[model samples]
Target: MKAVSELLKKHDGTLWHVTPAMTVFEAVEQLARLEVGALLVMDGDRLAGVFSERDYTRKITLLGRNSRETLVSEIMTANVITVNATTRTRECMSLMSARKIRHLPVVEGERVLGMISIRDIMDDIISDHEHTIASLESYIQS
Candidate 1:
């Protein structure tokens, strides 16, 4: 299995994020502008939390809170599940599946690298399978 580092290399290297003090409305706008499902909540250089569409839907919409007034820090998922560059893509997939999470931040020590989505894991798995199938077919032809 390819390491998460490989996937990171393939990415555009954009660490989409927002400040914890930002309003949910502002954060949501950033999410839409970046075309991402989640945004890493940064408290200066520290990784504070993660704000996602699910957070907005469950905490704001269901609770009848005002997104314009509510802070991202108030509703963001603070206990973030992260992976290091050395972690395998398969492991990331398993973690996401078990946690019912769609996004995972890649970190090293306390420094955040980037984020990966379930889509990234799926693409890696699919690509690996296709490569394996082609190799098998080539072997048979030989």
Candidate 2:
């Protein structure tokens, strides 16, 4: 099983974040520009919460709240589920499945390291399966 650290090593370590005070409109714009579903809501260096498309849909649109008037903190997921560098890929998949969440911020103690999506874990698993299948075919031919 691959560790979160190993998976993170395969990608650029860029954590896009927005302050809690930022308007939902701004956050949504950033999400669109970045082509990401979520952004870490940051209070200074702290991980405050996660502002996602789901939050916008459920809390703002469904509730008839104006994005320009609402703050990210108002609709963000306050209780964040985080993983560590040592967490296994399978473990991450399980957590995401149970929580019905797509993104997880990787943390080391109180400091944030990076973020991973369910897509990342699934891709790794698929790649590993392909590698194993190729190895088996090679061995059979030899």
Candidate 3:
């Protein structure tokens, strides 16, 4: 399995983020603009939390809180689960499945690397499977 670092290298290294003090409305706008399901909540260079569509729905919509008035920090998931660059994609898949989460922030010590989603993991898995199958077919032909 490929390491998380390899996967990050495949895509443009753009760490999309929102400040904790930003209003939920502003964060939501960023989400919409980026067409992403989540955004890392960063306090300067430090990761503070994660804000996602689920967080907005459950915390603001279901709770009847006003997004325009509420801060991202108030609704973001503070207990974020992270993975290091060396972590394998399969390990990340397992973590995401066990936690029932779609996004994970990749960090090393205090520095944030990037974020990965279920989509990224699934794509990697599918690619791996395809490669294996192709290898098997080639071996059989040989």
Name the candidate that leads on lDDT: 3
For model 1, the stretches where C-alpha displacement exceeds 4 angstroms are none
Would you list the rank order by TM-score, best first? Answer: 3, 1, 2
Question: Each model's C-alpha lDDT?
Answer: 0.93, 0.93, 0.96
Candidate 1, which ten residues in sequence have the lowest lDDT sum? 7-16
Task: Write model 1 residue lDDT over 28-138, tens digit each, in one string.
Answer: 999899888998999987899999999999999999999999999999999999999999999999999999999999999999988889988999999999999999999
User: What's model 1's lDDT at 141?
Assistant: 100
What CA root-mean-square deviation does each model show from the true structure?
0.8, 0.9, 0.7
Report the C-alpha lDDT of model 2 over 1-142, residue by residue, as the tens digit: 7999988886678879999999999999999999999988889989999999999999999999999999998889999999999999999999999999999999999998878888899999999899999999999999
RMSD of 1: 0.8
Candidate 3 is scored at a TM of 0.98
Clashing pairs in 1: none
Query: Could you tally the backbone clashes for each prediction?
Result: 0, 0, 0
What's the distance in Å from true for residue 8, model 1?
0.9
Worst 10 residues of 3 by lDDT: 6-15
Output the number of the TM-score-best candidate.
3
Candidate 3, residues 24-116, lDDT tens digits: the string is 999999999999999999999999999999999999999999999999999999999999999999999999999999999999999999999
